[model samples]
Every structure is written in C-alpha cells, then in structure tokens.
Target: MMFNIELKDVGKSYGDNEVLRDIDFSVDKGSFTAIVGKSGCGKSTLLRVIAKLEETSKGTLTFSGEGSKDPKIRIMFQDDRLIPWKNILSNISIGAVNKAAAKESLQEVGLIDKEKDWPDQLSGGQKQRIALARALASNPDILLFDEPLGALDALTRMEMQNLIEELWQQQQFTSLLVTHDVTEAVTLANRVIVIDKGTIQLDEKIDLPRPRERDEKFTYYEKKILNQILGG
Candidate 1:
C-alpha cells in the first residue's frame, strides 16, 4: 500500500510532560483511519503533530505522493469555527471562493440553500455541515477531523456520520479522525488505532465493506473495538 502520510518513532513533549512517544503509523492514500482513546490519551496532540499544527520533539515525518509539501491538509475542529460575521457561503469559501468549487462543496454537505444564512441562524448540525463544506472547499488531500461530531445529538450525529461517509467516498481524501466514540470508529473507519498513554496500543483494520450499516455485525465489531480500547 502506498502511504500518503508516515510517522516514524515520533515523540512530543511539553517540558517534563511527555504527551506522546515513539509513535509509528502510516496512512494509506484515500483511506479513512480513526484514532480512538480516552481523553488525555494524547489523541488530539498526536493529530496536531500530523496536521503540522505542532512540531514533534523527535523522529521523522514524511509525506509522499502529490503536492506533498503543503499537501492541502485541513483540520475540522469540534466547534464549527465558522466566522460569525460571514454568511454561510462566505464562511465556507474563507476568502478563497471559487464559485464552482464552493457551491459544489456546500451542496455535498446539504447546505446549498443555507449558504446565504448566518452561522447563528443554523442548528448545531447545520453549522457542522458548513464547517465540513469549508474543509472540502480547500480540495484537501488529507482531512483531519478532531471530534467534529462530538457536539451533535444522537440523531444528528448519525446523520452527520452518514454524510461524512458519503463525502469520503466521493472525495477520496486520506482522512484521520480523532474520536472518542467507539461505535463511530467501527462505522466510519477502514482502520482504527487505539491511542493510550501517549502511544498506539492497537492498530486494527476493519474488513467490513464500505457503507456499513449499524447492524448486528457492526455492533459485534464495535464491541470488540471498545474492548481493545478499554484494554479488555
């Protein structure tokens, strides 16, 4: 498998606090990989390092394939992070509005009509949709999702999950999602990495096909992943 992102013996620290150590992983091009773990397990910190938002203290990071240097990487945070003063359309475009690209991206997230609306005018789910639209607008090669669905209600979360799965299939970007939801890991990821105590404890692939429904089979797989993360 050709990897778009590679981390070898990576480590990060804040003075005496070692947030991550000796991490190694590779993300295959266009694959959806999820990092799941308890809070304070350094999942977000690890993601920050991958996104280049933070520099690692040790080891090497490499990128291969198209336009590797800046590689069109976009990070979607838990908050929608939309500019309140800007209309949804402007917010999604974020100063780089190509009429065709912005419109198509917004439509993909089901916010085409809401483009003119203000950020405050939309529900939590709608706001998130706009955020995803913004991330997609960049035509990113890699998309880093930092608990982007953490704030939604159960029903909305499910809907957003479906929307994300659809978009991933359509866009085919290498995606790394840092989430605490085990069911979400099972539902959306091609592989799941369990991050614990500043390092990856388990890395398992999901052999299930795409468009996975939360059926009995999914539930069983979810339980197994939950156990692995919980160290059972």
Candidate 2:
C-alpha cells in the first residue's frame, strides 16, 4: 500500500487571522476519508490546504505514491458551478483534451445522452453528475469534495452518494470529503475525521462492511461524530 498524503503541523492564516493550526494526518492511497466540522470551523480550509489551493502557514506537507508527485488533484464543491450557457458536453469537457475523452467521461457519469442539453435542462443531481464527470475527465489521482451533494434533496443526495462510492471503487482514487452531514460522512468514508476549532478532534476508522446499511454500528459512529460536532 502507498501513502497518499502526509500533513504534519499544518497551519494556515490570512494576515494574522488564523484559520487552521497544528493539523496532522496521513491518508493512504485509494482510501476515502471524510472530514466533518461545523461551519467556519476550518474544515474547508483544511481541505484547501491539502489540495494546495491555499499555501500552508506552517508545517510540512508531502505527497507520495503513483501520481502522488505532481498529482492531478481536483475539487468538487457544493455548487455544481456549471456554465449556464454551455451545453452539457461543452461543460464536462472543459478539462478534457478532446471530444472522445469528454464523451467517455460523460458516459462514465451516466449522462452520455445529455451532451446536447443545456445546463438549465438538468436537475440538481444531474448537474452534480456533470460536475463529477468534469472532475473525472481530468483523470485526477486525488479527489477533494466539499459537500458536493449537500444541495440535493434526501433521495437525490442518497443517489449521488451511491454514484460517488461506485466511481471511487472503480477508480481507486485517493479521496477526501468535507461535509457537515455526519451520517453522510460515516456512510462513505473508510475513516472519519472530526475537525474542531481548526484542529483534529477525532480520527476513527469505519470497520463496518461496505455497501453499509444504517445498522447499529453505523448509527453508533454517526452519533459519536454528531455528539462531537454538538460539543458533547
């Protein structure tokens, strides 16, 4: 097994306004990890730091394994961020080198036939699927998700979750998800990390089996994380 990320004493600040401090963690290659924290608790900042979008104020960060060095890291956000005027094919193919690759990725995300449809023609989940296809088109070795499924209704959100899990299993890409939904975190990640006050509050592995049902153990982990988020 290869190590995907090694972040030690990582901290971030913006002009003396500290947003993250003393963060440390290791993520293994091809693993899915979920980071959960309340709003403004620096969860998103931590994700950005890991993605190298924001330079770390202090600490050492390292990436290893295949594609780990100069890895193609991509991020998916709560908003689909699709261009309204662009057709679906044009939108998902933004990073693709050519049409074939774009069409392949679009099919991978189950939206092949929607290529000619406009963004407004799609539903929330469909737009998210397009965003996912766009990210996949880049062939990223690492995927960072900032609650991309947060905007959908319960049924749609669950459907997207399944889709993400399926895609991850097929690609075996190292992934990190930042979400406020504890259940969602527990349901998807092999490990659940709780961030509080810009620091890691808890790091627990999900030993439950895959295709995880909302069983007792799953519920227990969800409650445990929820309690921490509630400051219990």
Candidate 3:
C-alpha cells in the first residue's frame, strides 16, 4: 500500500502483435520515473496500459493513495491536444470543475493573461503550457507524460523541463514519463527504465540531484542508457 501504483506481470497484445511482456514495476508515491525505448518498441502502448486507455491482456494493476480507493490520474501528451475552438481558460475550466483552480493552474504555467485567447493564438510552447495547466488543474495525484516535449525547439524544451521539475518539486505527485531522449530522461527523473523489444532492458537509478545542470555531469548515465538502446 505504500506504493502509489504497481504493475504485476503486466502484458499487452493486439491480436498477434505483442506490445509489452511481463512488465513489472512499482512506482512509489511522489517519485518521478522515465521510460525510454526505440520507436515501435511498445513504449506508448505500455503507457496507455497504465492510463487504462487500453486494457491489459494479462496481469493486474493496483493503485492506492491519499486514502481514496482510486487515485486521481491525468496524462499529458506531445500533441498539446487543446480544443482549437475553445479559448484557453474555457478549455481548462470545462475539463476542471473549479474555475478558480483553472485560473490558478494557468498562473502556475505563466499563462494567466492568455486565458481568453484561442489555442491557435499561442506559440507551440505556450500551447503546451496551456495543456500542462489543464492537466494540473485537476490536481491529479498520478501524472503521465508521453513525449510531451518532443515537438518543441531546444530552448523551449529546456524551459518546459524546468517547469516540470519545478512543479513536481512543489506538488510531489507520482509522475511517469515516456520519452525517447536519454538526456531528458537523465535530467528529469529519479529513476530511468529502458525498454526493448517488448521487455524491460534496464531499470537504473539516476543518482544525480535535482535542479540538475544538463552539463557533462549526466553523461555517465546518459551514455549508459544510450548504449543500452543502441545495443552497444
């Protein structure tokens, strides 16, 4: 019960296609974990299984936290996926019941003033910020990210990374990120798990401390994971 989430012998398959196999991991409450793998390696499918967007073909997932039978969960993805027709504030408010909390979430993402603007009116980074604010508005105890920064430019991506770390530090939520970037994985997570060919290849702890500088300091773990993915 100490763990917020646990996967026991989890597996997923679409007809004959096996996406994940014997996946087993437990995420402690308030921990940040990153999952990395090559394209078509079932990374997204694994995340979807956690989200319950897709049912597991085998095994069980257990969740416990905050004295509630079910923990509140939310997911952020690469697309930002905002409603183009709805203005920024409305998008969040519609999804989140409390309008005041939606406003505060926008403020947390530094988008309080753009509440009335359409999604198309914002830049890519700003749009992603809105998406993040919407996710946070619900105050989910469990948050999942699927390459949320994959589409951003370098500078903006770094900014978003900082935002994520800052928010995680402030809110202490259990976070799971699925990313292809090894550097991003090392920079953001307390633990990094690498997947290959529908199985776990490596699950390593990132010993580096938070507010981590993306300098040569993280090269050791980054290269370790990179080599794992490259089959070196």
* Angstrom error at residue 113, model 3: 0.8
Model 3 clashing residue pairs (backbone): none
TM-scores, each model vs. reference? 0.95, 0.96, 0.96
Give the alpha carbon lDDT tens digit for every residue of 1-232 in model 1: 1239999999999999999999998889999999999899999999999899999999988888854455778899999988999898888877344868888899898879998899999999999998999988878888999999999999999999999999988878899999999989888998999988998888988888778877887887788778877882
> Which candidate comes out best when scored by TM-score?
3
Q: What CA RMSD would you report for each candidate? A: 1.9, 1.6, 1.6
lDDT of 2 by residue, 60-91 (tens): 99999854367778999999999998999999
Candidate 3, position 107, lDDT: 97
Error of 2 at 126 (Å): 0.5
Model 1 spans with C-alpha error above 4 angstroms: 1-3, 95-97
**What TM-score, to 2 decimals, does candidate 1 have?**
0.95
lDDT of 3 by residue, 1-232 (tens): 1238899999999999988999998989999999999998888898888888999999999897756777778899999999999999999886684999999999999989999999999999999999999999988888899999999999999999999999988998899999999999999999999999989999999998777976676888998899999992
Clashes in each model (backbone N, CA, C under 3 Å)? 0, 0, 0
lDDT of 1: 0.89
Residue 30 accuracy (lDDT) in model 1: 93
Question: What is residue 16's positional error in candidate 1, in angstroms?
Answer: 0.4
